[model samples]
Target: MPKKRRRISAFFKILTVLTVACGVLVAGGYYVIRSVQRVELTPPPPPSGCTLTAAGDTDELEVEQAANAATISGVAFGRDLPPHAVVVAFATVWQESKFRNIEFGDRDSVGLFQQRPSQEWGDPEQLMDPVYSSGEFYDGLVEIAGYEEMPVYEAAQAVQRSADGFAYDQHERRSRTMAAAFTGAEGPAVTCWYDTDEAGEADVEAAQAEMDRVFGTDGALPAAESRTGDPGWAMAAWAVANAERYGLTSVEYGGQRWSAAEGIDGWTEAPGEGGGAAAEDQVVLR
Candidate 1:
């Protein structure tokens, strides 16, 4: 072949090879992109439990149990009782029913503390109501002389007069941790998460009514700014504890926000002017 012809043939040969290689590369890249797209990119679901941490120790409770624990603590707060009262209540309830408000127990012993109607604690319906039962527990607790200074189990036994008073002792540490969290002794110590899809319809009026019933206040819901200090945090904790039941999407207080969407991450710095400085004192609920 002529030298020019041979050079043109060589050029075509190289061009053909390059074109085939480019097609292969493009196909491989397209497949790689499609494969990545086919893989699920959704985030892992959040854990379905609640945790209360205090003094570097942590304890876990199911969502309902946490709510009941919060109610027990909130009642004491409303009564202006000391955190010790909450500790005693927690220990007693932990021994009695693991924080579950059930209908059956040892011969009509019902509710969180297992108060028996036959023993004149209250009618079964009233005893089954967490707020009433918690109040009754505190009522009995306060009647005892020097309950604040007593061992948790002894104090609980003073009110409950249970078959195994010593059982309360085993739960004292856990009770203390939970009490601290629920009482707001440790700031924002209670963290809870749930499936947002499964959350019930939130009723603000009902929540307010229940809050009033437990706290013994007929007043309106206090603004977060007005309720600064441990009391505010306690209220915030109560809201978090009851978030699932009330369908609370987010709770903002002390410039931090706990969002149901990102609940597993717990509280994060609120977004706004000064990183939620305006919300520092305000507990905005949504």
Candidate 2:
């Protein structure tokens, strides 16, 4: 009887140990599964956008808007116009079309500045072209006497002749920030990011042609080594702005590099001397 009782007790002890072991294993597995679930539930970062920072303020822009803004600023730079001119143009475009190259607006208005064909701004197709429209805006802006010294809204009004001329005032601060960034008054101020799968294959020829058209410098992009200062940074910012359109992977200038893969982080110090074989004065595009 004593032996039998001892055997029974040993069986109960074994059973308790086994039960406790199984419970511990089950608890550990549940914890691991919950941890994996938490990791999987984390959302990915949003893609496809650009930002310009200047004077301690950051402004966000849709990728298309950024490209158009860069074109406008590029035209000004090509003309050797002051940054104030870019500010005026930005204000006008913001009020007119929010920097979008749209086909429709109030009273047959169209394109970036909402220039109407009936009013002889241009044919619809020509007005729809960003480079052409930007050039047209700058052409009119420069003709306004004392426009450089005028308030942003006043200068924009002189060029746009909008019904509510004062409306351009609302965008003055934002315009200044954009002008400063795109004009390279602030180095590496423009940063853009997008998905690589969506960027498509880069078209070097197309990018070169567009740069020539906007900057009016034929064969200049290939000779980026000759460029420097604000002009160099401006060209670098232009490449960044149009990266999505041209499928550009990277742009480097002034010892800093901006890559599409790490674009949101802005410009980082280059690994080698002036972006490796590219001169410090150059805006190297890849």
Candidate 3:
């Protein structure tokens, strides 16, 4: 009976060892498999706002400038102005304020275009407004004979009448980049990453009102109810240009999405509602 008991006890000990060994093998196999598998991590998008370069290079302020430049050029295009006008406007602004709407400048030079109130550009208050300053610049530009045929810097200098005529030349390349991206001449050219966390909900109403304030009540924007196509893209691009000030989170068009949180250097495929590149489309923000 004692021998029989000993045998049973030994058998139980073997069973226990086997159970622990199996557990160790199972755990080891799991670790090996996990280590061998490749885990792909999606890179985080850029900071919110806009990035103009292909390399995802740009700051919030510069992105704001790009967006404002888009609005300026967009308004010109809406008025049936030639493409050179947009380019010239961009270069001029780049030279003047680096696209900032400053309240101060060299001897009272103020606003995005650096239009001096002393020069009769407008009141100090009017010059602070980007739309008003852009209009003033265009007003002077269109008056120059054969301005359309002139070079971009020359055209800008003519309108600006700057002390140094060659200064505008420095901004020509960046101006062209911005003009092309915002004009929709280049597809998926402009991408902006902004702060969606603090931005809260998209403000379509404020965006529309600001659009009207800048582009005017003309047919520049689609009806509040809907938008699509090139016009839709144009409007959406405008929203992208102003995304920083407006708390706009994303602007979708042409089967692509530009999100502030995505920090994507450029537009990426967004194949869903309001994401199609149709003639009538929506500009999503928030």
Candidate number that wins on lDDT, 2 or 3: 2
User: For candidate 2, which ten residues in a row score worst on lDDT?
Assistant: 220-229
Clashes of 1: 0
Q: Which ten residues in a row have the lowest lDDT in candidate 1?
A: 220-229
lDDT of 3 at 168: 87
User: In model 2, how large is the Cα lDDT of residue 271?
Assistant: 74
What TM-score, to 2 decimals, does candidate 3 have? 0.72
Best candidate, TM-score-wise?
Answer: 2
Minimum summed lDDT over a 10-residue window in model 3 is located at 222-231
Residues 1-286 of candidate 3 have per-residue lDDT tens digits of 6999999999999999999999999999999899878677788644545665422333234566766776786567545566678789988887888877788889989888888888999999998887888888888998999998998889888888899978888877766666666666555666665656666566767887777665555434533332111345556677776776677766676567776656556577776554355423555554
Scored by Cα lDDT, where does model 3 land?
0.70
Q: How far off is residue 226 in model 1, in Å?
A: 14
- Any runs in candidate 2 off by more than 4 Å, and if so which? 1-45, 221-229, 273-275
Write down the TM-score for model 1.
Answer: 0.80
Clashes of 3: 19
lDDT-better candidate, 1 vs 2: 2
lDDT for 134 in candidate 2 is 82
For each candidate in turn, the TM-score is 0.80, 0.84, 0.72
